[model samples]
Target chain A: MKIIKFTFALLLCATISSCSSDDDTENLTGKLGNIIIKFDNGVDDQDFIFGTSYNTSSGESYKLETLKYLISNIRIKDNNGDTFMYPSEKNVFIIDEADGNNAGEIWVTLNDIAAANYTEITFGIGIDQDRYALGADGQGDFLAKAEEEGMMWSWATGFRFTRLDGTYSSDTVTDEALNIHMGSVGTAVDNYREVTLSLPNMAIVREDKTPELHVKADIAKLFDGTTSVSFDEGYSQVHVDETTTGVIANNAMDMFMVHHVHND
Target chain B: MKKIFLLASALMFWLGCAKSEIQENYVPIPLEVEQPSNFPDIVYNLDNNLVTEAGFELGKRLFYDGKLSANGAIPCAFCHEQAFAFTHHGHTVSHGVNGGIGTRNAQPLQNLAYQSEFMWDGAASHLDFQPIIPLTSELEMGETLTNVIDKLSLDIYYQEQFKKAFEDGEINSENMLKALSQFMLMLVSSNSKYDKYVREEDNVMLTQIELDGFETFQNKCASCHATDLFTDQSYRNNGLSINPKLNDEGRYSIFENPNDKYKFKVPSLRNVEKSFPYMHDGRFATLEAVLNFYDSGLVNNGNVDPTLLRNDNTYGITLNEYEKESIIAFLKTLTDNEFLTDERFSEY
Candidate 1:
């Protein structure tokens, strides 16, 4: 009986010492990880291709040589309803279709994100008025970046939130100029919009892992979403017109959806 | 007990090493902007971006540096010659890299700290963002912000200057623009003969002709060109005949509002004598020509400012030859020789 008790005591002492040793390691309560947002562009069922014709709901066919837009203020909601916002200074990004890889996927890698199980993601389609009011003081390298990308107006002092430069052919006119350069007219009419998308599954982010969220953006919805603007009806050349830009901005909000998540 | 203590010591040592790696080497030295007693409150919020000696020096270097252009030859100094109050002297429209010609005449760069908006049409809302327009315009510098940053990063002088000027110096756009602002904010033109006469300094007084011209100006031109700054900071249609070739719609293109058609920002006449070939497109070559145009050449551009309306249903100032000559004399007194020859802003 004494021998059995000695062996038990030895095992208990071994377990206690091991537990104490493990407690001496560093705690990771507030650690940072990285997340990749893969933007996949599509027109209806087929993938988006430059200079390829795509038919709209209004019987007007169009082909784009350039397709780009600005995305900013990215934030993700945790499973516990807590939100983690990326730093405002570096949150703005230009998702140019020309910058896509061979697989036609434009990947925006966000660094230093708080480690969490994110359930939903929210982002702005264009620059918000709050950011614009801050002026040059708020923007770091984004002003110059926007200018380089031809996403800024030369005559005016605002960004081209969505630049779709191409030609469209209506029933009456064939191969006419189609430039949908929508943006806020200074502090007057705001075309900025925000969109929130629910994830298909929880994106489990850890220090050693980088979870990728594949987002599918339907280009068809930009013309046929909530507003359903017609090309022949003054929607082809949307510059600073309040009514035309408002319809496009509202439609752009409904274009994004979380297709899948790769928690690798 | 000894193993637990040892493990704790090891963890503490690791954290101590990590903390030392992030230790900052930033040291700040303050530089004050000289505010002229006659000028209005500065529009630039200096609190957000404090000026420093190193930052000002860096800005001067970047201003003259040709690397800011696409071809590495046309710098900001190419168009903004200091002798002409930072304007392109003798050029109706400034030329840029690759034979690119700009549309509007180059605006002067003095007393910018007091003004809220920039450019002929008030396209640039802030002082810091004003450079981005010219820097990226294809007919101006024709350079991207990223390319300029990359080029400056490779230079040894900029690398060191950026470090000394900013705390978080990374040779980025923010530091570059802030440094440029520090240099520009220091440009104050407040020592002209007119200023001396108004302040009653050094027994300076305007001659009879200049005094008469000043009175005439106060009665006729003071409504739009109000204040000592010589600008009411309002956009107006001056009724100049629109050029068919350019067809520059002015401020109407900004918002596409029909009401804002042909309206342009009223320019400050601080160095009106030196900043000749005036107006947005440099159409008028001399002060006499500008006065004649206002007196008789005013066209009904539909959106002409109602302030210039006369009793005869005409839009003009109705100035006689003597009034024009005297006003020119008074305007000449506004040329501050000290600001024109100030070595602080000199490229050499």
Candidate 2:
């Protein structure tokens, strides 16, 4: 009778352990979730708006009619230093200012992300050479998307990494064309840049949960960060010029900051 | 219990096989693009959008279809006629939808797979994206990409073609552009008399005059118009007097670089005989006029190509009457009748 009782106890313990093990596996493996990255554009302390005038440190006031840029190659590093790269096929995005909500926030929702505590987010400001070399087939819908947004150069086969089309007023000129359409000039010059922002706190993601990350992009830093370029010195119309574009690209790198994260 | 487990396993295996069979429908038939013996390596990366028979046919159909244009009457074939080696036959600058007159002359569509860039200003960097310029230009097709895709999506023919052409085939701009690229990449013009003679095919040999012309071309014009492709593919200011009315700034307008002012891509003289009037603006009416311009009509444009500068500080090639005639003979040898009359590329 004692032998039978011992057998029963062993069987029950094994059953309980197996059940808990299965539950642990379900929680740890193949649990995919979603993440929303909110891009908030601002000119210094002021929120960016269409046709709204903003002053720059270089003694120039500017108002934008069109503002958009390309973002690509998104990746996130977990707390354990394991990096989770978004699928290359669908990683690229265009952040058009016109597509902002009433609160002036543009959201990019990334789905099928691995459930983990992400510490840092990294992304490219423009199309990279590897993506460009893939030609039209690799672009999928991005080519048409970029073209429709006017973030692509109609004349050249390249993405306009950053497009700030409007007018600028200085001591001499008032509301002259301030087209800052900067991009890589084919395979010769590469204006693409990568920016990595460390999250203020760990962003906890779970299978049933969707986390939101708010990133602030200071537009004024594009002109005055690292290298200070004045509008009067022919910096108003920025296109494929290596010096001017490099300056803008470098400055754009310092523009983004992870303001906060919501683990909801 | 054993019987029940066996039945469940069999059911699972059957379900897995059924899922795989459904996915097999999208398996693509890979098509290879031919590389001519005498030509340089193709610049187009074909690995991304491998050429398929269905895709090429769909592309050919799109090329001839006028539904891509806003007016629904102008097609790519309107300006690019196959008989004239895919150039606007007589127009200095071709007209498009709603009678919109374009500024630059229409370039021939030949050997595009080998070219890294497109347009006289090298505007487009890829063959697949080249159509966007003409398709959206107000002076060309005058249509937006979204409208074109929407129009194409409505057609039952395109819907079926898209399914046959691509695995993930939705009648979207991506597949549409890929189909167009597959067609353009196959338009190789390498069967010219010159090519045949060089490749030692068909017992072809150039006559004495043509041979002499080739020698003169080698010594005089080979620097810019180099290789079997007939162009080094460099942009240069070839000393043409600027047409102030048009004020076309050439490649300088691309980046606004002062050094690039008045520079235009050196055109391939593949079908130069049929593709006229020649030059970027189509200024020269005949081959003789073009030769004459190179001989004496060169202007002292500030950014003129340094290679064109003679010891006497002149910008003209010292070509006599006989040299001109022979060069023209050699240039005519580049006319590939096989390419011009290929039924595959023909509209009718």
Candidate 3:
């Protein structure tokens, strides 16, 4: 009887210990930081329009009823030069406002943000080539949401890598469409743009906490040297015009240099 | 101790009996279907709905029942006739419950598993989400989802089917959509003459005229209508003149881009003979009309595919009378009668 009781007691203790260990593991939640994205529509900001269209020499004048895109594959640099990239599983950031204008601010919660003074942050404007090439499943939050949000065009052929739209004037018409749609599917022209963010040096103090990352988007820079062209008179649309394709490709490439990469 | 042991045994046996009772109430469905050898496996299978004879029968009954429709005269089977490749015949646009017309042509559903996006504009990207648009569209069903659920909830027959198809016999939007998806996804089409020719599974032969037509199709139309599956999965301005009445911009409606003006997804030509009145607006009544539009009727403008536009403002691909006939003959090879008459998919 004593032997049976001893064995039962051992089994009970084993189960209890196992349960407690699970509880201890479950209690360990990771630290995270809030990311705020602010769109600076402020380079001569008088009702700034950032859109894609077919009315401009660039292609067409397009207005954004909705302009939410994915930014993922994030890497952060500390003051000591130690860099850490967020796990590929869930790294997506979106800044979108319908009605053809930037709403100025967006926010996302960053996970597993260890306590550190991060000096610089870098992330892709869209999904990277590797992730894009990895085909459907490698695409996580950003790609999935962009798809769900109707941003990603039917797989391959081409994706609207960047969409900028507003009214412009050609020689003949005033208030003509100035649209730039830059996308590349298949070949090297794949339109996923990589954008790095440099945060304005600010300290976020927490007991085992990381600072909040603030990224800025300048809507004015999209059409810095671009103008609108009229489709009614020019007899041109997206695929037919060299000017439209050139401007779109150049503007998307221009995004890399315009963004400042930093973390505070 | 003996009494307690006996009690525990009785408890175990009673639990087993209770589980068996649950089984007696719930019917399991068979999940057998043709999984294509070359193509990838189907991502979603109706394991929950189960493929039991009873479950499919119930689903078919629900599909054909006009009680789910707001007007009670229109059923799911009304617009989607089994005879016409699951698409309405001769109706340019599908008429809804109260004589309302839908924006785009009602696409004939077949080999839907291979489709990456749904709708002519590629709005609803998933099969699961596609039904929501039809069910909620004021023109189509004219009935709210809640009304359908409530109406189905009251039925004893549906209740039994739901019990067998889902856990605990619970009926909700998710399960309702899922059940519909199960029924619709099973509407697979792979036994066409074209499919057999490609598979080399049949001793079928094409005449020299049909061969010439096939060559013409390969040169002129194959870029959009690719082989085997028959769609390049891209939206293009197929030189269709916009209907002033519809004012449908196709992809432009979704993206709000003037560049995407008049661009529509290339429809698969798997069973094109049955899915007549081609194009987004269903303007053309016959395949000949569609070919004629491509042959010499493409309207000239910006965003039109360069291949379709001629230097003289006319569309490209001017086929002679014999060539037109041969092309039509080649197109007829795509018909899959077995798909339309499959006993597994048939309501009866």
Candidate 4:
């Protein structure tokens, strides 16, 4: 009975030590993993669908036919405050509403993420100045992809960073154009914005495991965000104007939030 | 035993050499692209994309290949012919795949490396991204970049070409564009009579009429058509009557800037003798018409150039019949026949 008890104690100690060693060598294992960021677009509480009428805070009703925005410079901060930035060449992504699944989830899969326990993610809303200034140097398939997606203006080299094409009904007028095609125009007007969201759960990335981050984009905040805009005014037809676009871009910065995370 | 080992090593060496020659036939043979003395410093960064013989050949093949288009026709060479300095010969507004007519006249391709911007309205700031405008244009080649990449990926010849041309050997848009740029960078047209005369090469001399026209051009036209490249590289309103049907707003459509209406990039006069139907829309058919319009056909088109403002409150560069004739004669001297008939740029 004593021999059995001694054996059990050794086994128990071995089990506990092995688990503690695993926790200690969590990040030092030198294994790479994958992280999938599923962008779930919503208008307040309801899921974003094409031609769905969503009311704004400014007493305006709108429905979108087309919606696409540039998302780039994706980075994640670990619990220990180590930031893992995605590779620059493969970082930029276009989250088109038309490219989304039936569940309206636009998946941006980040490959070769270092194994760690991530707590926060920071990402930019549009193509930044550095990527834009490179022109055709580092741009590979992304330029063609952007051209095919109508996210680029045909006449110029500038990209339409956020294309929101729809009709809005205000107090004065009926369904008119609400095209908020805002973007930086050749080093002159920069509208790029970044957002940092703290994840609700700790995303433990391992070699054999895949983690998913569901980020909800409250698109209603675009019009009724930090600066409430009225469609009845000249804010309906937004393009590359320095003033109007600045407000829309500032409003768009507050659109995203980390809804949930799953380490699967 | 030593003899047996020696025989085995010799066999392996022979096999390796033979395999390279047959299967993967590629050697990085650097091609020399000359920069003429009279021309400005090269704007294209050559360090990023070095021109090799294989790369240039691949670029030329791709330029002439009809598979780049939607209907298996209309390659870049379809519109840009080598004989006319790469302009569509006798085309006012060039037709594209499926009989689709374009809005602007096809511009001549020469001295592209020296220029900062491309297209009539300065649409393409970089020569690398210039092909995208026409490749995906509905009224042009009408093929998506993805579709073209897919088509190129399917070809065995292209597979070999990509392997020979690029370091990574990937049949992608980046390599394709780089290959095309290599070919275009090599298209140097610095052997014209004007170029020869300026450089004092081959004991070339200009006639009295040519010299007289050169003087007139220097006095009046040289302000906008400046330098040996023959362009100040500035967008201007040249006082052409608007074509109401097309109604192209030029650079104004870019930012909707009211001041930029009817402004187009001043084209270089190099190879201008062959690059007619002139103007942005190819409205004029001859140098005579172009000269006459400059002399007397100036009309107020809202924002006519202040430099073109006359003492009589009209916008024009006043010129006599002889001055006009001499300017045309001088413009003809800018034609480089060596570049026109160069076998390197030719499809045949």
Candidate 5:
């Protein structure tokens, strides 16, 4: 009976040639839609701006000139528990803070998503082991893009998942150079972390609707989340260290929260 | 008999038609990548970039092309000469564009498919991504991946090769790196005298001195050089006194872990004789010097491998003159002459 009802509803929408009717019914089948995942970087509440000082929990201050983080393997789980994954060839994205608009939002628009009533969104913070294992396949021209953005290290074959470069001043250290280039070190020390956030409200996707998920990334949580890392300590330059990077990666997992979704 | 002949002829005709159809459609001719039984399981994922005739050819051309460099002069083969098992012959460390010297020795190019990590410090995680380091390094090719792709796109020959090599047929970094990987996947060199002796092929036997060397090596060096591939594929600080000029922190630079300080990868001793000027920095010119260094010349650079530490609380392996001489003799048996002159991989 449910299947028949769903098909009848879809058929009616197909005849009407409109998926987003003001009525309670939605055409969540046999239609495609586009969704923009807007990444807004902030330090707790304030927008994270370049060269703007942000205080840490440990009486340390850091201002970043460059900030970028990779987001990949984005999958939207619908209300029915069925998940729709963005095609691998186009799913990987590097969210750069400098590329943000005047509103301090970096919009990554994923197109041709299967129409669904999505309730939860899950994504990986860095290049997954599977993607890294693919070698060059599925990676079209993103290597050059990452390299141009200084997200690729010349000495190694891995991508810098998160690149935060600036100065961090502590109680003793005055504006010491702070850089956090955290990424999984090959098949060895894996630092990749995934975060799943239940949407604040149901994101209704249809052929005519362009839903936008406004996701806030709290940059402060990277150093002050589950593990409070100090700038004067070993984490001032969080690199390929297994323990320190893993702690920060876990911290980064808690950074994202979907504030709201606007289906327009 | 007549009926059987008719059936055979009909089957032959069908097979001919199918083969011709493939030819006319320009379907890529697949090439077999041999996995030698003696080596470890292949680490390079072949499913991503399958070896084809056109792809391997394209990869070989790209490997030899100087257009990959900024100045269009230095090629991959410039540093990796075939005669010396792909190392820069007699160079301590390879020299590149504008006499730019590298910090580490150029490693050999054989048996790459079986290895998971690349570089002396395991900097490259995969075989396909390894070329990007040398291609983009300022001390090496000094060319951006995009710039190289752009230059390659101009060549009509490359255009044709790309069309033939990849299905999508775009001269992009993905296809370029995949083609390179396809070519490298075929560079298996598992027919060395030592390998033959182990596999019991062609009734090959190690000489008495070589057998003695094998025994000595097994007793002393086999802890790090564990597998038949001649390496456990691990990073260790083999105590060479620190070369402060380069101040190459080895794997430490990658992870900054204090325990990883001075830790270079325990390189495979597959073709130890031909790939001379050994060690990460190529400090020792001869195998004698290398063995002697292991015997006595090892410095306690703070992180010297505990394996190299003698039970008497001293550093270095205890190798006598006879043991050293035989080990060198056995090492010579690893020189794979066939792989060195293999026409498929050769630029000519």
Candidate 6:
């Protein structure tokens, strides 16, 4: 009789413990969803400024009164280096002169992210070719905002992918009206470039505290091709061209590496 | 008795665990969405869409509500009126917050599923993203999508509607646009006389005068204004002189090819009678003036279509007073009155 009672008590206790364990997991999982990313402009203590101008070799500057671009399709690599791409939404971040101070510090609220330690972060500069053809109906926040922001050219075609406007005076000709237009639509200058970031160490995301990653960007490399062309040359008529786009994309892609991320 | 108690306790524990697990992952099953009757099965149809009636109703409310605007002055209904076949009346350029004027004319909202493009410039291609244009344009609603979503997020009504639409009760831009698209896609128009004529269900009745006008249209306008939707869905040079202020080189703006200058999207004439002052610039106040201009006053330019030039000394579409009147009369038949008065379309 004593042995039977003990067995029954053990069974009841095991079931109760299992139920409580699940409840604890649920509570922890909900708390683990918080993620925070802080962007550090490489110029320490200097206010970050994002602006556009027509590159003129003559040093004539025309400020871009309106500017907007896309940063979409983010992917994060785990400590084991296994990569997981976040489900694509608008995935666009905007920094205006007012709110973000044009320094491009923005926050995103993400949920349901599995709790893990991540080593690297990667993302696309523009929309992928597949989603670009999907049109604007279901494209999350950024692509939809592209139209409202005039970043999209029109319906027959799609977004410019990237818009870099600068006025450049030809070395031979003194005319300042010349500018470079660089973007990707067809194969001529496909602007959709992927940026991969390798962290120095792993960044852990957990329950008691949220993980924060700081990324730094360099602006000088945007004009890497124009050695003879000085910023004083109005601006480099750095328009979207095949060669120029390659240089700019390569420069921007490297900007993500200038950061330190670790567990608190 | 002891064995029975153990069994009952074990069963109860498992059932409780399962219930708690379900509560954690519970996402409401959205209503099954079905294609509307009397419309062609277009590929853009929202299949497997768990669209609910309450969601659609909420979307309709947002569509007409001017409170979404920053100044609370211009609603989507302001530029797109239901009485005018979803096209504004006689306004060359639509007005928005603080009387700001938009660059393009207000386009009619209809049969958009067939279009692979949107806007006079064809910048946007999807129905879901169309609202983004007016919502953020300084000349339109002058509000950001994020700000609008943030405002709606706080509203108890919008929160519930988003839950029904997206199976998650969170008011994000995704669900907001989804709801808006759901409402806009339902604005389908296939009940027009033109539709009836296309189906051969009814005689496309035309007076002799209207018939003469149709013949002239076939010769002069049919090249660009093709059948079915009344557009080739291509850009063309209609020979309008460039306005220095606007500097709109039409397709040249995007293509950067000077040869493509003055080429604008060929607009549909479905509800053209109501959606005027006509032309890309809204230069013509009446259709008669437009006909007169096409008859004798085409600006000869490099990119102008050769077909639009005067041939056989006919001065292009050089229609006399009678021909012009008849052409105008035929154009009126393209109006879909059923679309103009349908309360189902009204954003209540």
Scoring each candidate complex against the real one, what DockQ results?
A: 0.01, 0.01, 0.01, 0.01, 0.01, 0.01
Cα deviation at A73, candidate 2, in Å, is 70
lDDT of each: 0.86, 0.86, 0.63, 0.86, 0.85, 0.63
Q: List model 2 lDDT by residue over A1-264, tens digit each.
A: 666887899999999988887844555458889999989787654456566556677888777888888899999999989999999989999998878653356899999999988999999999998888887776688888888888777535587899999899899999888989998878778999999999998887788888889888988888889888888887899998988998999999989999888786
Query: What is the DockQ (computed on Cα atoms) for candidate 5?
Result: 0.01
**lDDT per residue as tens, model 6, B196-221:** 65466667666677677777777768
| Displacement of the residue A153 alpha carbon in candidate 2, Å | 53
What are the per-residue Cα lDDT tens digits for candidate 3 across A1-264?
A: 766887899999999988888833533224445443333222221222233221223433334333444566777776667776887877755555442111223445565565455666677665567776776675555556666555566666434555544455445565655444445554455455565555567334234443444343434345543443344544223432445555544454343322332233
The residue pairs in collision within model 5 are none
Tens-digit lDDT track for model 4 on A1-264? Answer: 666887899999999988987866555457899999988777764556566566787878888888889999999999889999999999999998777653456889999999888999999988888888888678789989988988887535488888899999878888888898888776788888999999999888888888999888988898989999988887888887899889989999989998788776
Instruction: Encode model 5's per-residue lDDT on B141-178: one tens digit a residue.
Output: 99899999999989978877898888888899999999
Native-vs-model 6 lDDT? 0.63
Model 4 pairs in collision: none
**Which one wins by TM-score: 3 or 5?**
5
Question: What is the TM-score of candidate 2?
Answer: 0.53
Clashes of 2: 0
Give interface RMSD (Å), model 1. Answer: 23.8
The CA lDDT at A118 in model 1 is: 95
Off by over 4 Å in 3: A1-264, B1-24, B37-55, B310-314
Leading candidate by TM-score: 4
TM-score of 5: 0.54
- Lowest-scoring 10 consecutive residues by lDDT in candidate 4 chain B? B19-28
Residue B147 lDDT, candidate 4, scale 0-100: 94
lDDT per residue as tens, model 5, A121-191: 99999888888888778799988898898877753448789999999988798889999998888778777
